[model samples]
Target: MTDFSGLQQLTSLIRNIEAQMEGAKLMILTHEHREEIARHMVEGLVGPSREHKVRIETSSGEYMNQLAILEIGGNKYTFSKDHQGMFISEINYYTCRITPNSHGILVYHQDYPGVIHDVSRVLAENKINISSMNVSREQKGKSALLVSLTDEEIPQSLLSRLQQLPQVQQVLSLQ
Candidate 1:
């Protein structure tokens, strides 16, 4: 089976961050299935009765490519598909190329030296092996996102420990 949609990933991320969607609004700008996708996403989140809270809209012109922009609360997330497969191309103002089925941890932290080393040290201490990692930043010394695909699941306690590390703003485990 295919991995869940980018909308689902955004939903999970919102839930993980404990964002309130009860009375929040969602706007989808896409070339196709804007209504269906919006309905399903909102209904899944708040049920059919409260789906009205989310306002779905479509762009007058189609995107240059296969892409959709999902705007919820005050954050904007871009989803697109290409030969490499689907990706959540952008999160808020940060640019990232994250696949929905990426398994491991997503770390949001300050762009500084030793951050990666410290994170790696924590994982090594816990016997967690990272198969691969991708780091993206908007600018030097600014906020960055580290997507590490691990060989094994990272325990909750280690996640907490990582979150407690200096310059680490947030740590999320994905499997």
Candidate 2:
């Protein structure tokens, strides 16, 4: 992603902090080698001022991967960078894939055959077009997450249907 796109993506992740979060604490979790880039990301997200409601910190994490975890809105989200670019690596500790795509659906479900088809069918039935998709699984038949980029917002009824799926554990729509 371009710098602008990266900033836009970071803004989406931190929008809640700027809009409704009060007395927020943002933890930048990464390896020592990534402190510089992590700090730059923190500044981009919360700005340079110390008076904001967000408390920023850059702490050493366990690994050397180009990943950063943010604690905001009572949740922890992990974003990682790779050759493909920056995307959400996990949410609330669940392994998943999501980019700063700005609009998409995040589905946490059991790793099972046809889950992807089922999700696509639901969206297709509702006339929602999938622009892209990213799926990550911890193991076979175990916890998994699918992030689907769409052209439009997911309706509440469609979202409810997705939540009702037998393999689905959670459904989150991001815009």
The number of the candidate with the highest TM-score is 1
The regions of model 1 sitting more than 4 angstroms off are: 1-6, 43-52, 151-153
Report every candidate's CA lDDT.
Answer: 0.69, 0.69
Q: Write the per-residue lDDT of candidate 2 for residues 34-109, one digit (tens) a residue.
A: 5455555555565656345556666667544445666666767776766777766766676655666456678889
Question: Over the stretch 27-145, how does candidate 1's per-residue lDDT look in tens digits?
Answer: 55554666666655565455557425655656664565435565665667676666666666776666666665455788999999999999999999888888887788889999898
Give all TM-scores, in the order shown.
0.74, 0.67
Poorest lDDT segment (10 consecutive residues) of candidate 1: 1-10
In model 1, state the lDDT of residue 29.
52
